[model samples]
Target: MNARQGAATSVHVASPPEFHAVTGRSFAAGTPTKSSQKSDDRLTTARLWQVRADPA
Candidate 1:
């Protein structure tokens, strides 16, 4: 399926963070999959990025 289609699919949204690695550590850790890891990596290259980014 395509991006939009994939996003609307139950598999994507219903995917538990604990079961899927893509959403598990990656999503929980603010990191994406290995393929998309680079995109999010820039969100925080430093270890303190989260401290500065996420106020929660």
Candidate 2:
């Protein structure tokens, strides 16, 4: 590690144990969801995902 490195350009990840925090708030509506195939494939066929908020 050098002292002249760009330390301010790095992103910080702050997450606690037993839970993970993400920078996105959208849902995918294309796949059947995880079940037990042991496969790693994430593909969504939507342009936008809406998040409904309470009107109260």
Clashes of each: 0, 0
**Every candidate's lDDT:** 0.50, 0.29
Please, what are the lDDT tens digits per residue for candidate 2 over residues 1-56? 45434332122122333224443322233212344332222332121222223333
User: Where does model 1 exceed 4 Å of error?
Assistant: 1-10, 13-33, 37-56
Predicted candidate 2, C-alpha RMSD: 15.9
Root-mean-square deviation (CA) per prediction: 7.8, 15.9
Top of the candidates by TM-score: 1
Give lDDT for model 2: 0.29
TM-score for candidate 2: 0.13
Which segments of candidate 2 are over 4 A away from where they belong? 1-19, 29-56
Q: What's the lDDT for residue 28 in model 2?
A: 31
Expressed as tens digits, the lDDT of each residue in 1-56 for candidate 1 is 67765455445435667555434333213334354555457655564676778867
Q: Which ten residues in a row have the lowest lDDT in candidate 2?
A: 43-52
Candidate 1 residue 44 Cα shift, in angstroms, is: 3.4
